[model samples]
Target: MAKTIFITGASRGFGRIWAEAFLERGDQVVVTSRKGSGLSELVEKYGSAVLPLELDITNRAACFSALEKAKSHFGRVDVVINNAAMGVVGMVEELGEQESRDIIEANLFGTLWITQAALPILRAQGSGHILQLSSALGVYTFPSVGIYSASKFAVEGFSEALSLETKDMGIHVTIVEPNGFSTDFTASTIQSKPLPAYDQVRTALYSNPAMTESDTYGDPKATAAAILKLVDATNPPLRLFLGKKALPLAKAVYQQRLASWEEWNTVAIEAHGL
Candidate 1:
C-alpha cells in the first residue's frame, strides 16, 4: 500500500531527495519549505502526488496550520519527516546570543512543534512513523559547530525518549545521523561569528580543501534511498547512523565516552555511597 508522507525543508537537500524517492515509489508526499516557489516547481514536475506546502516550522501557528492542511489533503500522514534545520557555525562564545536562539528555534523547537502537532493525528491512526534528520554532530561535538551540535543532540535525546514513550502506542520514531554529504548544506551554511583567531583554521578545514580536492562526500540520493528502505521495513531501528564517515565516527565517540565513564566509575560509585 502507498503511504502518505509529510516532509519539511523539502525545497532542497535531503528533504527534496527523500520527497523524490517516495514519489518514485508511488507514495503520496506533501513537501514543505519556508518558500513555496521551489516546492511549486517540484510539484509541477511531479504532479498531484507531490503536494507543495509553504511553511515556516519555527512559527507555532504555521506548524499547526501545515499539519491541518496535510490532514485535510491526505486524511492522515503515515510518516512525518522532520528535516527542517538551520546550521549555526562558530564558537559558542563568539556567536551572538540571538544567533544561538535562532538556531535552537529552527532546529530544536521547530521539530518539537511539528512533532507535537502530528502526534495526535498519528495516534488516532494507530500507527505512524516519525523520522528526524540529525547529524554526526549529534553524537560527537566538533570545534566550530557547537550550536548545530547542541540542537542535534537535543533532537537525539528527544527522539530516544519519544521512541520509548511511544513503543506501545504504535508510533515509531527514528533518527538518522548522516555525515557530510554532497549537498548545498556546507555552501549554504551560515556562520554566526567571524573570529579572526580562527580564520586560518576555518579556511584550512572548510574552504581550502574543497577547492583543491574533488568532492568525495556521500550522495544525497543514497541517503534518500536509505531513508526509504528504513521507512518501508517491517522493523526499523530507533536510531540509524548513516554514511561511511558517520558509522565509524559514531562508534568511536560511543567507545571513547564509555571508556571515560568506566575510568570514573569508582569515583562515581563512591559519590553515590554504593
Candidate 2:
C-alpha cells in the first residue's frame, strides 16, 4: 500500500534521502524546506508524488497549516518525519545566550510544535507513525556540544512521553538517534567563538580516537532502507539508533551512570525521607 509521508527539512541530509526513497517506492511525500530552495529537483523528477512546501517549523501556526495543506492534497497522511532542527557547536561558556536559546527553540520547541500539529491528524486517522530526528548526543553528552546536546536531550524526553501517550490512539512515535554521519552535519553546524582557555579541551576532542576515527561516521544513504523497514513493522521501537555508534555509546554511558547512582544510593535514600 502506498503511504503519504510528510517530512520537514527534506531539501537535504537524511530528510532528502528518506523523501526520495519513499517517492521511488511509489509513496506520496510532502517535503518542506525553510527558504523552499533545493526542492525544484524533487518536483521536476517526482512530479505530483512530491509536494514541496516552504515551511519554518518553529512557527506553530505555519506547522499546523502545512499539515492541513498536506492532508488536503494527499487525502491522507500516514507518516510524519520531524527531521528539521538546528545545531550549535560550542563549549558550555562559549555559547552566546541567544545562540543557546535559538538552538533550543529550533530543535526542541520546533519539533514539539510539529509533533503537536501532526497528532490531531494522526489521531483522526487512527493509524500514523511519527519519526523524530534526535541525536546520539541526546542519550549521552560531550564537552564541546552541550547546547546542541541539551536541545536533543529535551527532544528525547518529550518524544518518549509522546510515544506512550499516542500508543492508545494507534499512533507510533519513533525517536531517531543518529551518531556522526558524513552529511555535512559537523561542517554545517553553527560554531561559536573559540575561548582560549578551552583550547586544550578542543585539542583533546580532536585527538580522541572515538571522535576522529574513520568508522565513527556512517553513510546517510544506507539509512533509508532501515527506516522503510521500521515504519513497515507491526511493532516498531520507540527509540531507534541510526548508526552503530549510538548503542555502544549508550551502553557505556548508562553503565557509568548506574554505577554512580548505586554509589550514591545511601544519600538518595536519605534525601527521599523514606
Candidate 3:
C-alpha cells in the first residue's frame, strides 16, 4: 500500500534520499526544510506525487501548520519521519551558552514540536508510524560533539518512551540510529570558538582520515530501503539501527554500562530504600 509520508530536513542527507525513495515507490511524499532550495528538483521530478514546503521545526506553530497543510492535501499522514537536526562541535567548556542552546532548540525541541504536532493526527486516524532519526552518538557520547550527542540522547529517551506509550494505540514509534554516511555533516556542522589548549586533542579526534571519509561511508539509499522495510513490518522494533557501525558501537557502550552497574550493584542497591 502506498503511504502518505511526511519528512523533515528533506533538503539534504538521509531525508532527501528517503523522500526520493518513497516517491519512487508511488508514496505520497510531503517534505520540508528551513528553505526550499533542495526540494525544487524533487517537485519537478515527481510532480504531484511530492509536496515541498518550507519548514523550521523549531517553531511549534509552524510545525502544526505544516502538518495541517499536509493533512489537508493528503487527507491523512500515514508516516512521519523526524529527520531534521544539526550538529555542533566543541568541548563543554569551549562551547558558548548560546551555541549550546541553539543546537538544543534545533535538534531536540525541533523534533519534539514535529512529534507533538503529529500525535493527535495519528491518534485520530487510529494508525500511523513515526520514525525518529537519531545517531549512534545518541546511545554513546564522544568528544568534540558533546552538545550534539546530548541532543540526540534526549531524542533517544523521548522516542523510546513514546514507543511504549503508543504501542497499543495502533501508532508505532521507532528511533533510528545511523552511523557515518556520505553526508556533508562535518562540513556543515556549527563550530564553537577554538581554544588553543584543546587544539591538539581536537585535531587528533576529528582529523582522522577515516572519520568523515566518503570512500567508506554507508549508502543512504540502502538505509532508506531499510527504513521502508521497518515500516512495512507487522511488528517493528522500538529502535532500528542503520549502518554496520551503529549496532557494534551501541552494544559495546551498553555492555560497558552494564558491567559498571553490576560491579557496583550491591553498593547501588544499598542506597535505595525498599
Candidate 4:
C-alpha cells in the first residue's frame, strides 16, 4: 500500500536520497529543506507526487507549521523522518555558547519539535512511524565532533523514551545511527574556533582512516533501502545501525561500558539503600 512520508532536510545528503527512494516506490513524500534547492529538482521530476516546503526546522513554530501543511497537503503522514540536523566539529572548549546553541537548536530541538507536532496527528489516526536520524557518534563519541555527538546522543535518549511511551498509542519510533556516508556532510560541517594547542589532535582526527574515508563514504541509497525495510517490518528494532563501520564500533563501545559497570558493581551496591 502507498504511504505518505514527511522528511525534513530533504534538500541534500541522506534526506534527499530517502525522499527520492520513496518517490521512486510510489510513496507520496512531503519534503522540506532550508532553501529547497534539491527539492526543486525532485518537484520537477516527480511532479505532484512530491510536496516541497521551504523550512528552517530550528524554529519550533516553523516546524509545527510545516508539519501542519504536510498533513493538510497529504491528508495524513504515515511516517515522519526527523532528518534535519546540522553538524559542529570542535573541542568542547573551542565551541562558544552561540556555536553550541546553533547545533543544539538545529539537531536536537528541531527533531523534538517535529516529533511533538507529529505525535498528535499519528495518535488521532491510531498508527504512525517516526524515524530519527541519529549517528554512530551518538553511541560513541569522536574527537572534534563533541558537540555534534552530544546532539545525537540527546536524540538517542529522546527517541528511546518516545518509543517506550508511544508503543501503547500504536506509534512506532526508531533511532537511526548511520556511520560515515558519502555525502557533503563533512564539507558542510560548521567548525568551532581553533585552538593552536588542539591542532595536533585535530589534525590526527581529520587524517584518521575513518575520517579520511572521503573516497569511501557509505552509500546513502543503501542505507535508505535498509530504512524502508525497517519501516515496513512488523517489528523493527528500537535502534537501527546503518553502514559497515557503525556496528562493530558501537558494539565495542557498549561492551566496554558494560564491563566498566560490572567492574564497578561493588561501588554501586555499596551506595544503594543508603
- What 10-residue stretch in candidate 2 is worst by lDDT? 180-189
lDDT of all predictions? 0.86, 0.92, 0.88, 0.88
Q: Give the poorly placed runs of model 2, Cα more than 4 Å off.
A: none
Worst 10 residues of 4 by lDDT: 210-219
Query: Model 1, 51: alpha-carbon shift in Å?
Result: 1.9
Return the TM-score for each candidate structure.
Answer: 0.93, 0.98, 0.94, 0.95
| Candidate 1 ranges beyond 4 A from true positions | 199-216
Winner by TM-score between candidate 4 and candidate 2 = 2
TM-score of 1: 0.93
Q: Model 3 clash pairs?
A: none
**Predicted candidate 2 versus true structure: per-residue lDDT over 133-177, tens digit per residue:** 998999999988899999999999999999888889999999999
What is candidate 1's CA lDDT for residue 116?
93
Per-residue lDDT of candidate 1, residues 1-274 (tens digit): 9999999999889988889889988999999988785787777777989878889899998998899899999888999999988887897667888878888999999999999989989999889999998988898876689889999999999989999999888999999888777888764467775878887767776664533445447777888778888998877898887777777756788999999999999999999974
The most accurate candidate by lDDT is 2
Poorest stretch of ten by lDDT in candidate 1: 207-216
Q: How well does candidate 4 score on lDDT at residue 172?
A: 91
RMSD of each: 2.3, 0.9, 1.8, 1.6
